[model samples]
Target: MGEIDTERQKLNCFRMRELGATVVPVKSGSRTLKDAVNEALRDWVTNIRTTHYIIGSAVGPHPFPDIVRDLQSVIGNEARAQMLNQTSGEFGHPTFTNGPGRLPDLVVACVGGGSNAIGMFNAFLEDKEVRIIGVEAGGEHGPWLPDGSDTDKHSATLTKGTVGVLHGSRTYLLQSPDGQIKETHSISAGLDYPGVGPQHASLKACGRVEYVFATDQQALDAMRTVSRKEGIVPALEPSHALHQTMEFAKSLPKDKIVLVNLCGRGDKDMLHVAKARGVVIDTDVKLNKTDFAQQ
Candidate 1:
């Protein structure tokens, strides 16, 4: 099950259809990642004998987080090897000076459910000299409504959340005073989750990794910057990390290297990015309202 009205859902719907997979768009609750996870859990529970559930991020209970992280660690392993294998001055980036067998001065990645960041950081965890950072979504500033309610305008779980149990895991969560989970906001659908992985919570507790945040505007600006300077349109998820990377890189010396996990492609984000930039994308294909009606 996927959230309705998300670029991820829209893109995945087409891909899943092509791959002969049925698409179920969850329209209930907040109609977001949390609701979709709820629906998926419900479905899995009902079909326990026949269905196997696979979580998308490094979250969920017990072995699931460990399984996801171990699988995703290939990203860090490959990146580390690639960087070490490159000869001196082979990496075109001016920041990379002492090329072969040299470890990066810093490593960074965005943290939503924390899979990608954990995967990227795992290889460098033992390297005491390497600095690691995880960037979260600093959506909008939440203000109290006249009705005495609060609007949850951020998804910076590690940076702002309190200890809570979510999805069968003890982790940091965006919650109310009474311990109710709060709805979160982010321009990136992937980073809009209210709870982070338990591993991240543990890391934060031990101070192994430093968690920070990048505002929606910062991510949008970074996306634009990458497009203009690097000729690559980065997905909003990675754009958060890129924003932090840019700021951190500015403070480092020319010889210090920073590696950012630019994970997702920006194909699905073109329309969203254009809309955010106040530019309308004219498309011959139109989506009918009935197409998204609750099943």
Candidate 2:
């Protein structure tokens, strides 16, 4: 899901490599997804004839974003149908069918290249009663970064970004006065973008959707909460949405329903989360004997 810099998936990485996957490790500019994209773009240009770039996000250009939204729209459609048909069965989970059984009061998803958010929000545009909230990855909050820069350390584009052209599209971006792309930070590699999809910017300007941010700490805390409460370790990206959903839930009554897109699981983020909590992983024997041990 994310945690690209953790280097903890040694066995899986080796397996992928043995399957002929080229693992070009990115080693610059925060060593996150943004830098990995830069490297990928650089490599794509080297041999355009033999390579076709299939982006993971919905932020690139006009038709590409539309294509992704169309494909991912299935997510919203399925969620809608599932919620509509949810009923309390003797053996299945209980369904709170006290009021209207169709559609939730609120829909929440994290914004990483705006794919999941756009996908979920597209189906609820006409439903005026349903609230759409997009959560951005809010990284470490402090006085600038380690380099003493004067920008936020989080990748909160719609909340902290302005209009600009980036990644072959005009949208909201985080940039310097010289128009240089500033580095973005997030515990989740999926959200390490300095820019967002243009449609999200339009949604923000038209006030059709509300955008918020959840810090790394908040997302991590939410991740643990869901893990313990629901027995699901969510990816850091969706953890942002989960964190915001908790905040939004506090204002509403207990009966009000909120649908959170738990997009990806946390199978890929254990090492990153462990490192964040001051635990070291020694799968590769990189640490001392007294430090970290592999089970």
Candidate 3:
């Protein structure tokens, strides 16, 4: 769901059709989700009698944004309720609260397309005291600035992007000097993106959400750490989020409660992991810089 690039969305649509679902192909904006959205709208106009376009992210038309937010609200709502129930039962009161049932002091989630982060942050948005942190992939390193410097090649869009349209919503985008959209790449395919959702941009601007990055190595380490320690193989995207937790754990109180969104399973990334480790799939070999330089 990262940035809703047209190619990936089209593939997803194809898969849906393969699964025996009725599918109407939409090819319109970036010819991705944005275009799909436009097509859905056209379908609604022409076949208003029977069409339902499922909005995926937190940004869109009024009812859509609101609907998505409400749907995602379940995450925070459930986490808070579960925390209350568990802590109250254990300590005769909720630890997050001074006494009986209470709320959490912090919330965190990994963001790519940002729906999960938005969902987790929504419940805590009203509580001025609760801190929300959104973790993103560190595409590359450069000078420090929340808005990012010209030297940055990273795609932590919420912290370093400009207002623009991508995937059907006005949002923060990673664009080239010519204003063309630049494709984003990452070891974690799920986090690869050139932009962030509009809602996340606004939240970052308003200081309600703090953005951070986890490098590829750090994410990989976290993936390994979780597998070794908890016997759980987390998706690489959420491993990026888990990396942040490990970073924070180093400085915070040992007992601090940290929750990570283990977004998806890791079955899809075996090939990627193998590739990253230099496990060659084909016998094709290329000469290195040293060989060329010597020649």
The local distance difference test score of each candidate is: 0.84, 0.80, 0.67
TM-score of each: 0.87, 0.83, 0.71
Q: Residue 167, candidate 2: how far off, in angstroms?
A: 0.8
Candidate 3 accuracy as lDDT? 0.67
lDDT-best of 2 and 3: 2
- Model 2 segments beyond 4 Å from truth? 1-20, 28-30, 86-100, 142-151, 285-295
Greater-TM-score candidate between 1 and 3 = 1
Off by over 4 Å in 1: 5-9, 86-99, 142-151, 286-295
Candidate 3 per-residue lDDT over residues 73-146, each given as its tens digit: 77766676565664443223243443224555556788876777888788678888777888887754521445
Residues 1-295, model 1: lDDT tens digits: 5364455446656777899987777888767888888788788899999999899798888899999899889788777766776433422343433445688999999999999999999988999999999999988642233475655788989987999998889999999979999988888888989999999999999999999988889999999899899999899999999999999999999989898999887777777777788888786686688876853
| Model 3 bad stretches (over 4 Å) | 1-51, 59-62, 86-102, 140-153, 280-295
Error of 1 at 203 (Å): 0.5
Best-matching candidate per lDDT: 1
lDDT of 2: 0.80
On the 0 to 100 scale, the lDDT of residue 213 in model 1 is 89
Error of 2 at 295 (Å): 19
Candidate 2, position 274, lDDT: 89
